[model samples]
Target chain A: MSKYTLREAMAIHASRQIRNEDKVIVGTGMPLVAAIIAKNCHAKDAVMLMEAGPFDSNPLALPSCVADPRGFVGAPWVADPVQMMGMILQQGRIDLGFLGGAQVDKYGNLNSTCLGTYKNANVRLPGSGGASDIGAMAKRNLIIIAHEARRLVEKVDYLTTPGWMLHPYENGKRVKDRLVHRKELGLWGGPEAVVTTMGIMKFEEETKVMYVSEYYADLGVTLEMIKENTGFAIDTSKADQVIPPTEDELYILRNVADPENIFI
Target chain B: MVSESKNSTKKTKIKTLQEAISQIPDGATILFGGWTVTRKPMAAVFEIIRQGKKDLHLVSNPGGPESDLLIGAGLVGISETNFIGHEVLGIPYCFRRAFEKGGLEKTGYLHDDWTVQTGALRILAGAMGIPFIPTKSLKGTEIIDPEHDLLADLRGKSKKLPNKKVEFIQDPFWDEGELLLIPAIKPDYCIIHVPMVGEEGTVRIHGGLFMDFYGALAAKKTIVTTEQITSEDYLKKQPDLNSIPAEFISDIVEVPYGGHPTAVQGMYDLDFEFFNRMVDSTKKEDTYVQWLQEWIKDLPDHDAYLEKLGVKKIFSLRADPGLGYNPRLKRKS
Candidate 1:
């Protein structure tokens, strides 16, 4: 069995969460890596779809973004992106969406939108593509971001995609009503999980608050570190039972990712 | 469709990119051709942003904040691009804030095989005079169902009612339908920026055409912006260099060095400092407008805009133009 690098292990851990029955929509970057790992390991039947309309296809390499045709080079099928947006996403075909964010808040809301305050502040990030739709429409959403205090903040400066608890209406309401009425949507019931380089986090089903669910093995980060970063109490039970990548998982990752030593 | 004669009589005139863009109406869907910052029509794009045309839908390859000028300006209401947010360079603040405020409308597409397959096949469909193309693509996936509505609009009269029961197709041997069909897309207008064009509107692109030429051909209308304009004789001299002939061109505006701030292949490297400033400026609509007014509005025309670049800077740019610059013979020392 090949040895896995820390990045691979982290990726695998995130990947294992996807269920075979789930329809997965993934964006670029580490999220793509994690989804691939999930497909190669636990979620074989998971329908892999990209925002660009490639389904269950293995790209030659991870695309820089969703539009780079390189991502769908090895896919089983490809479709027009405009069709994907106008028809598929609007119709609500995607089940689970996996995205990466620059910042995530206590409620699991994300801010990939900007670095500073809204309206005349600092750095501007890429605005939402379909993320707003995914955040609003997808049955389930998962976000993967690197673990850092700066990233896991109390409140995101910008809400690129507002999550569930932040919804305006309670229980079942029209999507538009819930989006429009809410003065501020907190991460009440939005993201199912947030995978990080340091550990995995999930919202408490009852409280709709973020809590640490898992931690990587052989890593020096502590539960307190997670708490310090997140500013919330974490469930140790889930964190301790975190699954480690198997030997076979390591083999696939090393062969697939094969990061250069210098870059690593 | 508008008749060709109506467009044929339209005079081809010299204008800066901004002035050319000012002519476009509101709610116009524009197809921006370029791969990221490589060959974008920056001047036209900047002018569009400055004009603050609302409900603009842009179709192009996603290139982060460098490409977010429209989004930042609150001009973009819809996009059929692949990605946004700066992955490497830095995100544009205006776009980010607008997103956070839920003020922008956006649609993302996948890149890679899907983008190429769809774009290529759709263009082929248009070129072939077909309404749609059938491919094995998206077969067996959730995208196959009309309920998934990957192509069929499920809202208003165009709404596709979901028939959830998967039906079996009866054949001589097999009794089941095997695949799903994805519809083709023909854009309303395609905007292209090239290295050079002749007076007759013959375009010459230096690098791989990618899907730009196909998109232009497939679109109903084609608008071209170029970095340099030469005589019609020069175009005839190099017939092989022309990617799209004058017949294909619907409207041509000679905008010399049109792609400013954004990189133009064989012309200039991306003005990162300007991009960063734009990113910072995008945070507020007023500021963004002010920035646009300062850079784009004040420039009277393309010639004046080029003059703003200054001869010394242009000479420096000419000396080491990245991809397509050809050195002219030096005078005897």
Candidate 2:
């Protein structure tokens, strides 16, 4: 019922979370959309690091698997994709990481590397580019996926990234001990929030459990709809606001992000 | 030298696009001037392919299928470019397959480095009569020396050849006794396609003049093929709109709608059917030759070439008819 497309809504919601001067690591696809939206809406100083080693510079619109000009055409500075991954992302210089997921679980783990299973799958997808580095080193991560039961699953076919997992340790002490690690370190780690067409959801920082926060305005869909689709619990009180893109936000999106087409 | 005089003094009537390409020699360094899908010199490129000029060193911005045609013909000995992937436009599968198969040789630079870093800066350097411009593009990157051996070799034996300091060291205090300045790329010839040109060779481009003037000014010779030819008075009417003045030009050939099979703005839209045909072909040398012969060689002249395109179809597709055909100029009427 929102005026924005599912992709546009996802971008609008993700854009709200980014601070004005945050250094974000952006990948291709939905990540590029979110970064462009953030830059146009609020994050003016958002530096876009492309895989082709250009910072915030737009190249001629050309089709490329990894180094598309759209990724950095409107960015402030461009850097080498490899150097960005190694020196910037891995070094934890990036504040927030925006990514897309093919499959997501209750724990917020995302699977984009494979389909069906790691070794054998019904289909194959483009394997991870810089997602691993961003997921590992970024202090905070936001994931965007279209709301559907098929995408929101109990378990992913393959574990492309380890979100939150149990850690074992041996020690001699009377006091109890619980050692926890974020997913990037090979231990189980999950995302902070997941934005979808139907509603928004966030994982409990302590429990690493996902709960629905808000529904899209007048989305005839209910908490039960999200619960049934996600196979998870719904948190209604946390759903304070579901913001739509403003006129200025929409203008920037149309002009800067998708000039030739209004699809996004 | 004799051929040069003959080409310069006497106006050689080249009947077809293929005839014009036979003039170029082997191993000639060429600078291609145009942005993506616009203002590209398709006629000259086609001619070069038809003549089968071998061991050519081509310099240009990233391109689509046309780049493949040269690589497919085994004419490109060396290519210095920013990017080579297929954009929304079809990929040059031959170029990709050739590179993957280790058949074609190339030296790659970052897209920004090729476009803004080396191209624009090199042009300014040439215009100012400077030797080179210092850039910070490839510093501390994998494209440095051993990783890009071909690029290093292109720099040659001059110790200052692959100067890294010129691009990096921002402060004089940080001088590590070294600097890397990208040498100006002075090509042997430059080729371009334009919307209009006067009999005196003044050129006008419509939108996005991406590094065309830079390539032309840096190169030794400049050749232009235009969609239409107008008079000097008409050209002088829009002096501010002119992209390159006739004084800088070395040769001017009036080949109206010469950008067939490739899109020429205002005159003709892209001949997608022809482009697709080229894409689907088996990509053998003989197949390409046969393909060119079928489309180009059989035509008698420019008028017949236009006739083959079908006047009805050209007019129907013409968003603006006035944009095409200036009879007074003796281009296509």
For all candidates listed, what's the TM-score of chain B alone?
Answer: 0.71, 0.76
Q: What share of the true interface contacts does each candidate keep?
A: 0.07, 0.01
Model 1 per-residue lDDT tens digits across residues B128-242: 5686654322222111223322223322343121222122222334433332233444566777777787766788875335456666777777778886787767788878867
Best by DockQ: 1
Local distance difference test values of all predictions, in order: 0.57, 0.56
Candidate 2: tens digits of C-alpha lDDT, residues A1-264 = 226565666667777777787766555555666566777678877765544344553323311223432332334554533345535654566677777768777766666544553323344333333454455556677788888887887766644443543221222111114424443223222366888877778876667767777676644556766767774455565664576568777666666665544235
Cα lDDT tens digits, model 1, A47-77, are: 7776655666565444444444345455665
Off by over 4 Å in 2: A2-264, B1-20, B104-116, B151-180, B261-268, B271-277, B280-293, B296-305, B320-333
Q: Positional deviation of B278 in candidate 2, in angstroms?
A: 3.4
**Best candidate (score: TM-score):** 2
Worst 10 residues of 1 chain B by lDDT: B107-116
Q: For model 2, how does the per-residue alpha-carbon lDDT over B101-175 read when each residue is reduced to its tens digit?
A: 333224231111132234445555554567776543332222222322344444546332333212323336555
